[model samples]
Target: MWRIDFFLDNGYENVSMNDIVKHAGGSLATLYKHFGNKEQLFIYILEQKSEEVFGEWGRKSVCYEGRIEEFLTETGRMFLDLVTTPDAILFHRLLISIGYINDSRLNKTQIQNLMSVPVIIIANYLENEKVNGHIEVEDTYLVAEQFLNAVKGPFLFQTILGIQIDISEETRLKALKQVVTIFCRGLHVIQ
Candidate 1:
């Protein structure tokens, strides 16, 4: 956790394994043995954060109960809350930097795993709904991708670019509500 915090405070290249060992109170050999190297440590941190944000997302069962709009709106709100946090923003920026800088540290598989977790979760939920006649989705995976993009589109780029990092609660709720409304309308959840 300290290593992750250090990485977030300092950029990827700025932080070193020595710094991590110092702040985290661990031996270099232990870190090396566990993570294999600094880059691997960073990747592990990303994995932990991704799990923290998107893990057990569907644990609290969605109660459709004839109010699909409510479910969609709540899910959209959760997605926004998870992705728009300061830490999440920082994590994504680090990911982008690693990607563009040609850092082979973050392998393609790790990148896909980081992104695919939520997509898989949402797609599975949609698949179940389609099966039960709650909604008619021809391709649940594509719809899930579209839904995530729609929710994150308004804020991710601005925050990642540092154009506007902070989002007020009122604005956040309003935007999420609008996204949810449009998503429901598109899916014909409400007519």
Candidate 2:
């Protein structure tokens, strides 16, 4: 928790093994012995936080009284709630900060791949839906990515960048309906 806390509170570039060890109550040798280096430690923390943040969504069931709109609405609402969270925003900003540091040894693509749990979840759902003739998409993965990016991009970006932190429930619901409707229409959903 301390390792994640340190990195999220202080930008990734500003934190050090010493700072972590100091705050986490561990010796530098032990930290090095366990994590090997700062990069590994950061990666470990990133993976841990990623799992913690996304695990619940991954566990979300696609079942919603057999309604695709209901499933999509739930997913979109969850995504909106997830990204607007303070912890999530800080985590996202940490990633953004890492992007500007060349010496971090972890590239943007690496982080993106690591953080692709939502895309995987969506793709699997879309693939299942397509098989059942509930939707039609040439490529489930690409369509899933497009849906996720389009659905969550604006409000997420606004809150994350401090442009607008408190999106009203009415606004979120409206956005969810619009995104889900557009996505379903694009996919040529049968229902």
Candidate 3:
């Protein structure tokens, strides 16, 4: 797992099963049998990573049910942490860079689908929050986009454009808190 991540981080384009076999110190036959192909392996890795994050999110959200402030506070903190995490940002940048390039192994549809995972997860969380009476929004999709934009816009701009800016933990927490607060205002249920 670390080998594949390292290779991707090192800007290896068109990572193949052979590459995985050599880098991962595993047999090509075993890699093929387990993951089928490079695309499958990538998707599998993404799923594993998503599970690691969302599993904790699930537990925490459920535990903090009925308390929108606490839920959003915890969620925002965790989410900002995830967004700024080195591994998460690196993998995200790699995916964005590779997603547009034509790979012989994975087609356009598969890549598009993989890229939509984040939006899907965000929308699902917003929908769940709404159902739990945490926030009231007419459109979860748009709300999800806004939520993502609030969190990702600055980080991605700096990352992709090489804009040097001091990003402190305190700044991240403040940004996250503001995003949640503004979003909650827009989504608050009318009494």
| TM-score of each predicted structure versus truth | 0.86, 0.88, 0.81
lDDT tens per residue, model 2, 88-145: 8898888888887777776566578778878887788888888888887889999878
- Candidate models: Cα lDDT each: 0.76, 0.78, 0.67
Q: Model 2 — TM-score against the truth?
A: 0.88
Candidates arranged by TM-score, highest first: 2, 1, 3
Q: Estimate the overall C-alpha local distance difference test score of candidate 1.
A: 0.76
In the range 29-106, model 3's lDDT, one tens digit per residue, is 888898887667776766676666676666554565455556666766666677776666676677667766665444
Query: Which of 2 and 3 is the better model by TM-score?
Result: 2
Q: Highest lDDT among the candidates is held by which one?
A: 2
